[model samples]
Target: MSLLIIRLLVFVLVFWAGWRLWQYWQGFQNQRVEEQQGKDGHESMVKCEECGLHLPSSEAIQSGKLHFCCSEHRDAYNTPPRDDKDN
Candidate 1:
């Protein structure tokens, strides 16, 4: 009877250890996947040439090689400055 009890306890202990290991492995895999997704979803930041505002490239307005925070800024930057001497 004692031998049987010991065998049962060992089996339970092994099963518990295996279950814990499986749980840990699943958590590790989930963390890795989350990190990968974060990296893939990252957007590059750009500076607006007009206002010097920093924002994601996806949201910035692009005019040739320059970036702007808004249409007004883009227009303001693109328009040539008035010459006071000529006026």
Candidate 2:
């Protein structure tokens, strides 16, 4: 009877350890995902000069030295005759 109790106790301990390990692994994965999201957020944002719109750089139209919220704004700023007179 004592031997059986010892075996049962060992099995329970092993099960508990495994459960704890799984929980830790899940937490670690969640932390990694959060870190990746933070990095992506930092990499994504860009400032638009035309209307001071903050948007993802990937979605913004980029002119020579500025970011625009859309192509229309970029083209408006890119008008050659007006740009030339200003320079």
Candidate 1, position 50, lDDT: 91
User: What is the C-alpha lDDT profile of model 1 across 1-87, one tens digit per residue?
Assistant: 999999999999999999999999999998887675467656678999998999988789999999999999999998999889965
- Which tens-of-lDDT digit does each residue in 1-87 have in candidate 2? 999999999999999999999999999998887676575435467888767889977688888768999987787667664445756
Error of 1 at 29 (Å): 18
Model 1 score (lDDT): 0.91
Off by over 4 Å in 1: 1-39
**Highest lDDT: which candidate?**
1
Error of 2 at 62 (Å): 9.2
Query: What is the TM-score of candidate 1?
Result: 0.51
